[model samples]
Target: MSVNGDSEQQDWPRPSSSWIDKVLFLGTGTSGQVPAIHCVTKPDFGDCAACKDATLNPTGKNRRGCTAAAVVGRSAGDKQESTILIDCGKTFYSNAVVHFPRNGIRELRAVLLTHAHADAILGLDDLRAWTMGGVIQRHVPIYLTQECMTVVEGMFPYLVDRSKSTGGGDVPTLQWNIIDKDKPFTIPASQGRKEVHIQPLPVLHGYFGRSSPFWCLGFRIDSFSYISDCHEIPADTLQLIRGSQAIVMDALKMDRHLSHFSFAQALSFFASFSPPPALGLLTDFTHRIEHYATQEQVDTWRDGMLAAQLAGKAKLSRSVGEGGGTKWWSDIWDERDNEHQMTIRLREKYDPIDDHNISQTASHYIPPIKLSWDGLVVPFDPRRSPSMP
Candidate 1:
């Protein structure tokens, strides 16, 4: 479905009281997560740097859970803030135990599931903590596509149809709402003046063939968009999120995979925007991605793109390594893949339009492209803090 784009910065009205105060990155890794069992438990220890770092430092940027987030805000005239969980994945319980109390997230107002993958919906049973024993006064509402709801019903029959529950100490009371991928819907209102509006972005995740592709959803809320998993975004879906102020996209690893975007692919998409998003963060990473090294790699690419725009160059010739190499990028460059070619084409098409915003200090037009870690918190408004390391 098409949602209006805020092409011009002035067109976005500043909210006196932000509808969304902040977004907390509950988890930022793929289903397997960081510090994989084999990586740390091997006799000689595995060679994965990200997993090793996560093992040594229990609470570090290298440590990550599943890809999930919480949208936190207090609607107008509400006494308490409402938290809408984006995805309750495999590590939802562990992630919530640590972060929920630390961030003052007491109650879950609603849940929005992107899809019914194990990493996205396996934690449905854990919501019993809030629903049982009258911990939460009312039944929790969950919104998902009809296909996803069907999967949930199969996986957690007790959760969907309470009559099927047997010998249950306590089961979560829930209300299911089936959503349409082509429609934009609103979260059920609480004691508030406004309800959060969400736009569903259906994109390809994986496929059996050209005609039958697995559908995964990305969501658009105000100026923020989150697509935790995607292989390709259709042209129409791309237009829906064109002028987003802040975005969290999937960049699984340095190499192109069948179902997810690679580092360069995500970078190319981010840079294709007119002025680029104010804040562009990458998530859903794999073990191959070491936290600090990936950050440096992204910084180098973002800098090169900004430099090309500033110089009015049609191609990027900023090679940083010796023998015409470019450090980390050179190591992962796949001549067989078309990612490099796509990057060049995007520079030729969108670089000229960003000329007016590019300057000697090019941080304004060039969004900070960060490899988001677990527990990283960012303001929902891009104008408040546009750049965060």
Candidate 2:
């Protein structure tokens, strides 16, 4: 799908009063998830970060799970605000249990999809539990491209086949809303006088130059854009999200992937979009986020990142929402992966958008990227955010 972002920002939805800013990082590990059942810490890879993290944090945020998150209405009063949930992945059930309890949800308005990847859509079955016995039950809307919708339907025939009975327990009640990548759509606002309009920014999900590009979506909702799984962000799509202050994207692993972003690929994508400053999802972890050798791209990036942070890289870490407190991100890491704001600033200093810089960045990356664990929530402002020059 081709989307022209000439002046699409006008279509963005205004913020509402009923919603809160908190984005709970539900799951951040990839498909196999961290602490893979078949993980070996020595032979092939080195010390297991997943196992180490699990040991240190235990039930805390250092623990990783499937990818997903919940955005709740931030309120302390009597009125229970509206609830809007993003992707419901494989670990969404467990991750939700860990992160969703903080913001109590009264009404679930819609479900947005990045793509119908299992790591992104598996927990859809669990959505039934949310509607099981509510006083005013509602069929949550599932928004996605027709291709994705068909896949979802194929996976769960009973969801659409009315004649099919729910063997015993409750099945997820849903309202399938087919989405067009070229057209922007609006969902009921949770806390504002107006609705929240989400613009789809279509980008190629794999390869720099593939025989047939696997084009997928990365959404632009105000100042924040989310691309859960993708390998390449075309020039046009980059321009659309360039203005976002906080952009969350897929950082499957430090390794190269087939259909997902590798360490360098994700960094390059982030570099193009970062407006002087910007920072950054999830999927599998077992075979994906393998032990990083000292020479791995992620290790290099991490080392460079630490150095930049120590040297006072632009203060990129900002509180995402009102109630999230400082520990929110780590708790989630205690939960997913993405880029850093430093890469943007550092790349600008490295050189202008020249072939040399792009070449340097692209040279290390081997295409056909795989992905990692999921579960993360971040904050962003659609209206008031900086833009790339």
Candidate 3:
């Protein structure tokens, strides 16, 4: 599907200088956060770094759920500040409380939701606490896509219900503004002196049973775009973010899956948007692909992309993975090569097992795999026999 260019620009309010300085990446991840509830509740839950502390490494595993919000506008100090939250996942309330403390923010302006998934909107109730306690006394305006609003009202009846009396004198009230996909809207920022234009980019979520359909979306905030829980990135959406400074997207894992973009797919997507300032993969928290696997997957994809360039489909002129705190793409690729050699050397250290049976039989038996800086592989499996090949 393509975006209507005419509609996107028509009636668009001119951006003010005050709005330019605001924006921060609040949270990033898929619906089920890292170190999921099951992980923490399981009897044999090992001492995982993420499990040990929630704030130090706020990932999908350690955080409440997968949601990101950005705040916009200037702070009370009159410094230009504007933040926008991409998704409001289950732990949004607590995460927000910790991340954006009362002393830190002068206002909690708008919340933009990417989709209607549970992890994205479950924290709607928590805003009430902020409202009731006189923390954010003013009505907070929430902007959502029309499709998302339908799902929100259907899923959260109480929040949308105007008749119910919130026992706490006056609960935090929400003003909903339905955003038209075809048209862009400006949110008041910089203490209402500036406006930030938000454009909705349509994407495909997993299909529903037999005949029904579900819609997912990503938002383009000026030069940055955030898309999570999507299987495919539509061409039109790509066009909208053609020159983005950063594109934060979902890279579920290494292997191909039916409903999500595997790490390879994510790399392909990044290649499609070649030469972007930076690209970050989020919404990752699966045991199948541990931290090492995630980095490996990234390396594999980068290598593949580089290889494809020989045939001319890829023409990356700048260094990849360098802009972000992530290592340079060349460094990662070099590491991958080193890792391959190390894997060969360690071959005798691991018992050869069928790939298909590895998950069912040896997943838990094996310790976490570590990827060396030069790309060497070390099998931490204690079950390895000296005679093993």
Candidate 4:
């Protein structure tokens, strides 16, 4: 399936001056999230031993569900801003509120759907809260592939058949845009801001009912690529994701699964990949894989990757992103590495970005980076890519 955007292009043009500064991971857990109910219902006699500790550590990663993120853009002096939501799955509304400020939903410009699965599209209706308010409300735009539209219409007949009776209560106010595979599409940063292009790469998801294969998508926006929920990555899709500076793909567990990539399989795919992404991450983890264990695994991998780059065994691509930063190139031996180390600097004289004032609705970036107990947000840019910190 294809849309109004280019299906095949050598490259999606990067904004010469600036672009979105960061992509924040909203929730990184698999469909059931961590603390799976079955863990208790069916105890270790046959229950989840790995997730056993998730009960004691309520705020731990194993307690998570639904994976998504916010792609944020801002202007100098905070004159303009844009927030694009990737997917609003079943847990989206709950997770978004925790990650973003009160106005998070109200400020979204678009919603991109990777597929029609319940975990990926369930929270869609909750968007009505954003559309029903304000003196002048506007319909939110939703982007999806033709294959997705078919399943979506079947699932939410009310959303497709506008003619249906509503009995006066508000429903999702949306406008749908069909994206063409291998095609790149553009969305304005804001009303007068520059445009950001999103590249849609088609991937083959495993069969739905044992006899019929289905399709899903992964997207490349600017310097990063996000691939979720695919059992297989086709040759064409790999070609499309080749040049991303950072990539976050699905690796649902440590062991092989019918519908998702195990951690080893995921790492192997990119380890041998050409023009490998500078920083590679695995997401969409299920409770079966303990959060602490996965975090330790990722940390170990990062250490090894940095060691390889330092020893000249691997090449780390350089890139940079926005706000309170610069654009430059350097080698590992360069002393400038110290200068590029992320340091928080307040733009204001006295209004500090303390925990007290760190609102999700902040007009500009809070600082270079922010860490949390549940997840982490690492800033990225195309101009500078440093070793993992």
Off by over 4 Å in 4: 1-18, 42-50, 74-79, 102-106, 135-137, 188-190, 210-212, 298-375, 382-389
lDDT of 1 by residue, 23-106 (tens): 788999999999888888975456788888898897888899999998887655777788889998999999999888777887
> Residue 308 lDDT in model 3?
33
Off by over 4 Å in 3: 1-25, 37-64, 71-79, 166-170, 189-192, 210-212, 300-389
lDDT of 3 by residue, 1-389 (tens): 00112232232222222222333334444565565566567555555444434434543323434546463433225445555556666777666665465225545657777778787787777777656656654566788888789888887766777666456535457778888765667776555445567778777777766364466777876555567667766656666765554455665644555556655445535543533432334444433334544454444444343433332333233543312212223321333333334221111122233333332332111111111110111111112111100
Instruction: State how far residue 93 of model 1 sits from its true place (Å).
Output: 0.9
TM-score for each candidate, following the candidate numbering: 0.81, 0.65, 0.65, 0.71
- lDDT per model vs. reference: 0.72, 0.52, 0.50, 0.59
Alpha carbon deviation, residue 5, candidate 3 (Å): 41
The most accurate candidate by TM-score is 1
Quick one: how many clashes does candidate 1 have? Answer: 0
Better of 2 and 3 by lDDT: 2
Ranking of all candidate structures by their TM-score, best first: 1, 4, 2, 3
Ranking by lDDT: 1, 4, 2, 3
lDDT of 2 at 127: 80
Model 2 stretches astray by more than 4 angstroms: 1-20, 40-46, 55-57, 60-62, 72-80, 189-193, 207-211, 281-389
